[model samples]
Target: MSTIELKNLVISKISEVNDEAFLLAINTILDSKSESILILSDDQKSSIKKSQKEYLEGNYFSNDSVNEEMEKWLKQ
Candidate 1:
């Protein structure tokens, strides 16, 4: 179906729904769709840049090393 037709169908179906929980879930989904864009804090932006730089520099633990560490941690 076309986008407009689909939207009208959803609106029609929503109007018929009487369950409070279901209505609330639909409201939450709609609200999420209309949410404003997120703005990252300076610290968060800096952290992302640092992580990217580290990744580019190859200053990161190997998968095996991380798995070994995780295994040791799980044992503890």
Candidate 2:
């Protein structure tokens, strides 16, 4: 298969994953191989970089924050 086709298949399989650690490993491997692989689009590359930075900086929201938002929506 072509490189882009292989990347698409890998991305599709990655999306089917639900385990956080496994996803991180997959992303890390992809990043390491990036120089030798097809470049990700600007948006996709930005999103991955942003998410990794957020994760590294402990910038994620809590489940309670989501629950509170949901409750507020229900009350409206």
Candidate 3:
């Protein structure tokens, strides 16, 4: 079906829905869909940039090293 037709069909179906729990579930789905944008804080942006720079400079630890440290910490 076309987009407009599908939307109309959905609206018609929604209008026919009378169950409280089902209506709440549909409302929750619509609410989640409406909040699609992600807004990051300035601190989060700065941290992401710093991490990217460190990764490009090869200043991060290796997976093996991190695993070894974790194993040692677990033993302690």
Candidate 4:
């Protein structure tokens, strides 16, 4: 089923459920699972890993440079 259909079904089920328990159960069900499979290109995965390594190694740009670029773009 499509997302809209799935959402409608969930809403219908929740409506029949007791209010107090429904919210907690829904929140748990909606939380992202780390074990879920994802598809990414090798290059994309490599890029992410490289960036993560850089962050871990403390090789990063200062906030000043990032803000300067953002300010320049905002003026354009």
What does candidate 4 score in Cα RMSD to the true structure?
12.0
Clashes of 1: 0
Tell me, by TM-score, which candidate is best. 3
lDDT of 4 by residue, 1-76 (tens): 9999998998898888877877886767676554366889999999999999999999998899999999999999
The TM-score measured for candidate 4 stands at 0.37
Candidate 1 deviant stretches above 4 angstroms? 2-4, 15-25, 32-38, 69-76
lDDT of 1 by residue, 4-42 (tens): 999999999999999999999999988988886788999
- lDDT: which candidate is best? 3
| lDDT on C-alpha atoms for all candidate structures | 0.95, 0.91, 0.97, 0.87
Output the better candidate (3/4) by lDDT.
3
Off by over 4 Å in 4: 1-38, 68-76
Off by over 4 Å in 3: 1-12, 33-37, 72-76
Cα lDDT of model 3 by residue, 1-76, tens digit: 9999999999999999999999999999999998887889999999999999999999999999999999999999
Give per-model TM-scores: 0.55, 0.40, 0.61, 0.37
lDDT of 2 at 21: 97
Tell me which residue pairs clash in candidate 4: none
